[model samples]
Target: MTATAAFEAWAAQHHIDAPHIAIKQTQHAGTGLFAKQAIVTHTEPLLRIPNDMLITTKNATHLHLTEEFRNTIYQLFDGTDEMHLEGKNERLFLKLFLVHERFVHANDSFWKPYMDVLPSLAFFQENHVLFKNYAEHLAGTTLSVSISAKQRALQNELATLQEKACGWLDQITLEQWFWADATFWSRVVSLDEENEAVDNGQATHLALVPFFDFANHSLTPNVRWQRDSQDNSFLLMPFEDATIGAHDELFISYGAKSNQELLFLHGFTLSNNPEPLRLRLPVTPFLAGPSQPAISRFLQQNAMEPFVAFGYSHDSAPSSSSQVLPDFPIAHQLFASTGFTYPSIVLMYLLALDEDDGLRIDEQENIVLGNKQVDAMDGVAEYTSQLEHFKVIQLRVILLLLDALTYHHGELSQSIPETTHPSALTNHIAAYRLEEKHSFECAIDALALLREELLQEPVVIQYMSSQEQQ
Candidate 1:
């Protein structure tokens, strides 16, 4: 039977009598759901999947298997077989592995029809191959390291499972296991309140819903879904009047995800993702200066990390909130208004310093520890007395950030040559980099403007200080 016929048969077995949507192959988006008839806005559910039909870890536990097989699966699930992955992730991998094994090896396996329609592992493997082959092209990129870490974790899990499966060891290849992992990564849905109760909260409940996974993503989605508490089924409906005519594809919003997230998780990048790109800078280096010991102690006492992330939105102002900082209202308001965090932290550190310690410029134009200047304020109260010190710290922090941004911009520019010819792979990489470069440029411009504003503040502070003295 053809793949569509196989899927139809599978749907029929599950009592899905009449689906309003049909699966169609697209050149760019793989398989997606298309409307079979005109769907009105807020129409009744397009599809309802029964609870028993859903494949989840809770349901998978009920499958009858030999004690040895169960033991091996349990070992893999606990990560006692390996040390890196979490127990929850191991359980997920175990479920998918069992599903794939039963589908391929057992004629009596109930999940066979469902498995037959899934896109081959090679379909998803191509993207992984691209990442491996073009590693250098993606150097200095935030996503490259993340992808590498995932790949490593996947390989470790697969190897652990292979070592334990003595009897069925030769039945599956690592490639097939990789495919199973990808299947979980792409299609698994998180359980809502109703479904969570069924799992007793022992583990995170996730399931694979047949036919429902075919709806492609859109930044602006027309479809909405709800989990039925009575029957434990999921109901999909149109949020707005379905402008989708017969044969038009139906789209669902995957939430407001960044382009990088969409690319890695869904294997596609949005041309116009409105979310900002985040750049992380390590605070450890900054903490190494002599006067920063107290700052480090403060961070440790508060259980904060030595890193700060700057989010650069193409169309909005840069955001300065650090996940590491405590959320006191006054500090939060100040940080948000300034549109930067590191500078404020630096300013706070400077204010905390004893008057005996002073800041001096080094040969490299970097701030360094220097001999005490008697003119420096002597105490916390005195520091606050001259509010001009706040502007001084802000100016210094802006200059430091500008230098860092310039370095990153230069690195990204030099990595890709101007005259390189394009291929299919190159085109894909170029698109990803274009978004990254755009974000960097936007951040640079925003920072430059902020520097100008901050420069004027110091003059004002000095004038105000002189006026106060008079």
Candidate 2:
């Protein structure tokens, strides 16, 4: 049968109601679901996919296969080769392998119709250069680290799988496995809490819901989904009082994700994602010398660690109406938001002592030894007197961050061309890089504003002693 005929047969076998929606190709978004008629607000489910029809790790465990095949699959699933697969989940990899196997021998497979409808490997391969440049340009950012780590893990898994497959590796290439991985990451949805399988609690239980996967993402989605308790099926419903006009494509929210995350996972970026840009700062520099033990103890006491994150929203897309002042108190606020309290703690330490004194613990009480003058004052008074010093340190930190942002912005700005001939893949990569470049530029601008704002603060005027006034 033709691919469409196979899909229609599969939908018919599952009793998919076809009157409400139909799958169609869009000029830009590939294949997506469009409304056949006006879907009323708060209407009943547009689609209900039964549990048995869902492809999941739980289902994979029970698939009928030869003893050798099952054992190898289990070994891969268990992740016994820990050296290569550290900190990676094996279930998704194993499930994809089985799906690939089934697709190869389609005569005996149950999911041929669904498998046939999946986009080809070429669709994902076209963006290789973009992903490569993204990794290179965003070298130190969290998003870059995450992408690199995942790529490494995928490479290791494919190597191991290929080795174990013995002569069968000819059937599925590493590229095919990558395509499956991308498909799973982009389209799979977690099972509802009420429908979660027991063994899959630690790992999120996911399934590929056939027609539901076609709904493109929107920041402001008009539709929501839930599990039907009665039949153990997934039910796609409209968000409260939101109506879908006739011929309007259905859209669902993928949660409040950052542009980096959207681009990495879904191959697209939102032009106006409201999440603030965050910069991760290592705490190792602050923990050198005698301060290490004291810093460690302080972090232990406060339930924190050696890394801290600082972030700011650009005025153009402020995460909130209230602006965050770049001041001494902002460090405390940063501590509260991220568990990285080292910045505020280090500032206090610097304030209580002269630079020559260094950080030393008192023999009597494990307290940080400092200039006896500040130590004589009460806690609040001591901190208040150090405001100017703290402001100076804060300025230094902001400048360092701005320099890093400027470096990334420069790298990205130089990588893409001035223009490109319009093709689907080139257009997509252009849009993705544009969003990334814009985010970097916005962050640089925000940091420059913060620097200016900090320089204007009255505390920047060094405090003068009576002797100095002579």
Candidate 3:
């Protein structure tokens, strides 16, 4: 058998779905990683990335050096430059590595001379800074660890990146503007509280996992797991209950739909060849700013604890005669805001109900059933459809906000907090951990406007009048 064929066979045995690439038999940039297919809202896609693909900080560095970074080293150092190495492998590795940006480099002694010469090119040049700073131990010796092929330099972290990006933005003149900076903030909006926590130790640990790398970002994903060996790691699987189509892009999202497939999909689909046909999962297009919140933390903190007394557990309680308690101002305000508010409120309740228990669909029509205890598919549909009535009202409010914000501040609409649920959510004490959320100035303005509009209602007027008389 040919050498590549032999390798392919071995890779297949080792559980590589795309054995051709593993065996170095072919390159797959043209084929792409996914295919076209119809996928249900929750379903599993075959795992293309095996656990083996999970490059560690040490191994990743080694791969960076050996896999393809050789040329840059050879050109920059081997000749009269600085690193005068005489070996064949040294020349070949350096030559190959220059072409491959993703190569993992591991030789500190070898890189030291090159670093001494090329001090200003990149950080960690002379002192073996790469391994000395990022990694604790490699081969039982201290080694510079690359987090993954993606972050070879170990420079970017979600929190730190946000800080640096924002700082840079603040320095820019008013005429200078960039959307990429704003996009980073969106990722910040979705970060878990722990990921962004300040008190957490290990300053350089918050690695940003690429969203497209995982390919799925749902509120409730199908798979769930924690790695048996890796510290601070978890695995995801698709939900067993959801059906996946042939060409859909499968993603591991935040959803805990089933114990079987740790998967999450919004407008999700399953497909055999998903790269070309995967459905567009629900992602807010807006640049995540202060207006957008880290919702997972927000929901966890605000959701009523099962056993806690509703009126007394929180400080903002109201009298018995009150239709809505002060503590539940958001709940009270929902119905009064616009024509769509009622149905939107219903959908929120329905999603909460399904999420609280286990959500299931009817065996026949795939109709969503709430709490195996209650078959409320028709009710859900009615509420979901009624939301359509608010389309005009929603568009108008958005137009008003945009027009107002634009006239007030000579820029196009920066963000629309009032249109979203997370921004509208009050009683958000958790968001102020350590310091108040710096991302919510626009959202706060939106809420103040909403509250002002609500206060004009006759019900609020009557409520205030009665309180004044008493």
- By TM-score, rank the candidates, best first: 1, 2, 3
TM-score for each prediction? 0.73, 0.71, 0.26
Residue 365, model 2, lDDT: 26
- Which residue pairs of candidate 1 clash? 41-241
Model 2 over residues 326-368: C-alpha lDDT tens digits? 3335434422222123354344444334343333466532434
Task: At residue 36, give the lDDT of candidate 3.
Answer: 36
- The 10-residue segment of model 3 with minimum total lDDT is 305-314
In candidate 2, clashing pairs total: 0
In what order do the candidates fall by lDDT, top score first? 1, 2, 3
Off by over 4 Å in 2: 16-19, 40-42, 61-69, 77-99, 102-107, 127-146, 160-172, 193-203, 276-357, 360-388, 432-434, 449-460, 463-470
Top-scoring candidate (lDDT): 1
Error of 2 at 317 (Å): 6.3
Better of 2 and 3 by TM-score: 2
lDDT of 3 by residue, 382-422 (tens): 43334422222332333433343334232112211232233
